[model samples]
Target: MTQKIEFIDLKAQYRALKDAIDARIHKVLNHGQYIMGPEVRELEERLEDYTGAKHCITVASGTEALLISLMALGIGPGDEVITTPFTFVATAEVIVLLGAVPVFVDIEPDTCNIDASKIEAAITPKTKAIMPVSLYGQPADMDEINAIAERYGLPVIEDAAQSFGATYKGKKSCNLSTIGCTSFFPSKPLGCYGDGGAIFTTDDVLAKACREIRVHGQKRRYYHTRIGVGGRMDTLQCAIVLAKLERFDWEIEQRMKLGARYNQLLDKHGYQRVKQRNDRTSVFAQYTVFVENRDAIAKQLNEQGIPTAVHYPVPLNRQPAYKDICHGTVTAVAERVAKQVMSLPMGPDLAESDQQRIVAALSEAVKIGGF
Candidate 1:
């Protein structure tokens, strides 16, 4: 009936930080150091302190961050990495790209994150590590996952692309595991202007390896120490993130408040909102909820001018790209969640009035979809 509201409201964010953002871009332009520039180091330092992690290495993109982390771990042909199939393909794609096997596990139906209990059963002599995606901005049960990894002496990498500002039991998302990888693809909780990403870690050797891998495995300039990739984050993108950091705290706070408000609104209306454990706080990167007749509901919401999307309508194991790679069985919970999960408008700049509008429209849509 009316024009759809912006899903992420990036314009609102830009309007709020126009001057600062422009100034940051202009500074980058003035310096003309686009690759591995001063701002890159500055942002890395800020992010390290923010995450309370010992090291942070900015990379070309979130996917690149994952690749670099895997490469640094010495994952190679024939190795198997345990991960979920309900996440963004990059979680499993990177492992497969390295010639390593992506051992698909199922996710927790409520959280749509890797089920820690399912991981141990999937491991084998070929299992090298565990990579868990922080789906919809909530960390997986890291304490349990870490415990399992410690017992097996395996490394864990948190795919925190959606959960950068999220917290788990008081620890930051990217700092909760052996290595954490995140993306800044503009729509993320903490995004940059263009594609950029980073890897977080406390291990000195892993950190060093990641740094080397990010820059073509060079020990010094042009001196190749090992096989690697050209994965350095651009300076301009770093500057944008640096500028956004000025308001990042406020943005994250708004996200948490909005998430709680969404939960309250949905539960008040009798919607089956996804449960968030008390020990973990989701940044609500997607503000997703489950309902009957998801497709019909999404269509009705679209007709009412509220833009909505599915985080993933299909699990990775079911995808064409992954089916041939893994001949193993898929998790039932992940498949069920995939059919029901729908992401509503989410971002720091999403207005309360807009949220109310969304909730009202959605309530109507759900009733229509149920029919």
Candidate 2:
């Protein structure tokens, strides 16, 4: 085995942008306005421009973004938000935190995205919103979901935590639905050095509501307009994101090329890789695939100096906390995918040679695992 492959090469990314990142950090330190400083608004403005959104509200984390979005929409007790179970817990966690119900939906097996075709059946009079997780950094069926949302007069919130730079139908992911939320957790496509996130909205009222909700619902300092949370993104984190923006475009392109190459390589060996829709693109935050004997294969990869991850090992519907409430949701697909899904090392810094090595190792590991 050669040198170990990093699951996410943040070190390589930092080394490449050391100067810009240092400058950004130093500027933030000199200003000393750590809370809600100038960099916060600056990052919001740039992200708005990047996503073509009317407003961008910086928040403390991806979970905060979802919470703020839900609060802005006035989701509360007894209200339901339709979402998939095959995603990070945050997607459903925020809904539960707000005293709302997360109505679990099945996912498309190939894409691991919320199955839009199955969403309508779950919706009822209590459904206030449709929250779709763009699992694995590929936008879900937003157009279909949006159409369904329109008919029901329900708002759509896109959980784009893993897909800041992805596009769907010629539009950016975080700008697709009624309110789009993205994360800047260090491993995300457009991550900062630490936890951060943003909310994108075209509605002025909703945007204003989100902005206030992030800061304890204050329209002005020391004045309460409504209930809110202390969810503002830190100034330094915003600055770091701004610095990362310098190379973000190049990185997105690299992700596309690398993701395409991985698909090609994996396909040549008859591996069941995640599928991407033709009308959209995935940032491949985690280049996932299905396999038999997952644990044994992962152990083999580990022994061979390659890192592997399971984006999700259990569907939210099956989790101890959610099982009772989500009983009878009937997500056979999510349950099956959770067992077989595995993520390969992915990032813009990933080398093609490394991808070849990984694929070859995986092919052999599968054989050894009795597949």
Candidate 3:
């Protein structure tokens, strides 16, 4: 008989939180304040305190959160936002949507984050901000990125879509930058039932700007204060997150412990893992690894009932949609990683036995492929 393994076991998590989640949903149903409801404010406060950010503005989605942050910073036409090509398209998409150019920077081969060393060289008079993605739940070198941004007087936006619960140098990922945006797209570290996201910031002015932007730029009823978007988080989603928070700490702990265990097992078995910087803690959003015959290995794992995924099969620079939008040439590291990276089953609810099974399958796959 074959044992079933999931790429991400969300059902297991739901089972664990059924009662709390049901109660929260019932509360939302009773209130009937779905849009920008009281639960929205409550979730925002909780997230703000969790991230140590001065303010948190919940939004419709992570994409909207990023767009609103860009709008808040006035990063519009003729401006340039420096970023990495290894990230999801949204990082660059929001830039283009605001009529700003995305200056693609190279990434560090190990961390797969925007190379802070290469950032200074990319700076130009048009550079408005440095947007570094915390790819795969590990934060980029914000200290170095922030230093470069400060030198050029540019704001830093951390696209922390995969790293909401991550930490760097004893500080949270979202709190490290001028502005941070995260998603609650169910697969994320702190996901809700449906689409949701939030913006974190220490700057009071930017916080206020983001709040206004999230509500169609409304400062008051029927009064447009500034250019904004319809990006409010739903009350039901907020309620779900509020309930998830009850066990979030424990869930983060489980992810960290399991991620470390995967690292150990893979290393002992001669599999290469995605490198996490020593200065930070990753929540193992995907538990990715690099393999010699990545596609063949993934297929073999699937044959054994061990599910796997690729965070990205292609680099943004090589994608059809991004082929012509380049402000610079593609980096060699990002290009190489796109073909080699594979994500194994990972989630807080993933059992130790299931993880061992995944490792064993991968080990066998490696031998089968002559790796």
Candidate 4:
């Protein structure tokens, strides 16, 4: 009998770190400071130390992190933020919410990340920032993007929602740009039990602005300075993250190893996957592959007790809501890949035996359907 596999085995992770997590939660319960408790600062300091960034501001969610970062920069209507079209909607949604246009650029076919070469051409006088999503837990060509931003005097905000714990050129993903934002959504690599996120920046001035923007633009308890949002991650969530952090490094290591193992297995079976650059390490937030007849394949996998998912099926430029707002330039690569990408079960707790079974089942499914 084949063992059942979980797409992301959060239960396994919880089991592995239950004691610490429970203690942290109990500590929070005893204090009764759910909103911005001491654990909030403690988590921030731990994250800052982990990423080597000068500051880390905990926020309500990854979406809020982006919005607050943009607000801190004073990005309002008519400003253009250049970014990839092939990521989660929140990447573009945050820009649109601020009344800024997300200038959609095509992604690289192999990695599904914003093509750094294509980014320079998208810049205009109205371009305020370059927001790059680290799709599938891999950082984009941040160095190249940063160089272009420097030439144009623009800030780079890395939408690292999927790439936390990943390293780019020996530097962590969230610290690769002017402002780095990450999600702690339950499914993310370093997720909390609920919505949580953090902003990373080496710039003190920008850091100050982000901190103020998260709490109704307050420098003091009741003082309001600039326009802001009520975007504060609760104490419970912070405590959960702190507990998870205790084993984060080891989990990231497991993800890397599993990703490599997946690569080897898939390659042996003549399957193609999203490419990882040599200079960077992806946390494999979602281990994905290129496949056709996604619906048929997914159905087959479901029947076999294997599960699959599509990271995205439509590019933002093609979505009805965004088609009108984003510049009408066609992102051919994004459009093509969106139709072909499919995610396999992935997590730090994935067992090697389960991984082999998943690959074998996938290989069999692909061959039988000729997809």
Would you estimate the TM-scores of all the predictions? 0.98, 0.99, 0.98, 0.98
lDDT of 2 by residue, 1-371 (tens): 46899998999999999999999999989989999999999999999999999999999999999999999999998889999999889988988888889999899989999999999999888999999988788899999999999999999999999999999999999999999999999999999878999999999999999999999999999999999999999999999999999999999999999999989888887889799999999999999989889999999999988999998999998889988775237999999988899999999999888888899999999889844
RMSD for all candidates, in order, please. 1.1, 0.9, 0.9, 1.0
Considering only N, C-alpha and C atoms within 3 Å, which residue pairs clash in candidate 1?
none
Q: How would you encode candidate 3's per-residue C-alpha lDDT over 166-204 as one tens digit per residue?
A: 999999989998999999999899999889999999899
* lDDT (C-alpha) at residue 281 in model 2: 93
Candidate 4's residue-wise lDDT over 324-345, tens digit each?
9997367998998888999999
Better of 2 and 3 by lDDT: 2
Which sections of candidate 4 miss by over 4 Å?
1-3
**lDDT minimum window of 10 residues, candidate 1:** 322-331
Go through the candidates in order and give each one's C-alpha lDDT: 0.90, 0.92, 0.90, 0.92
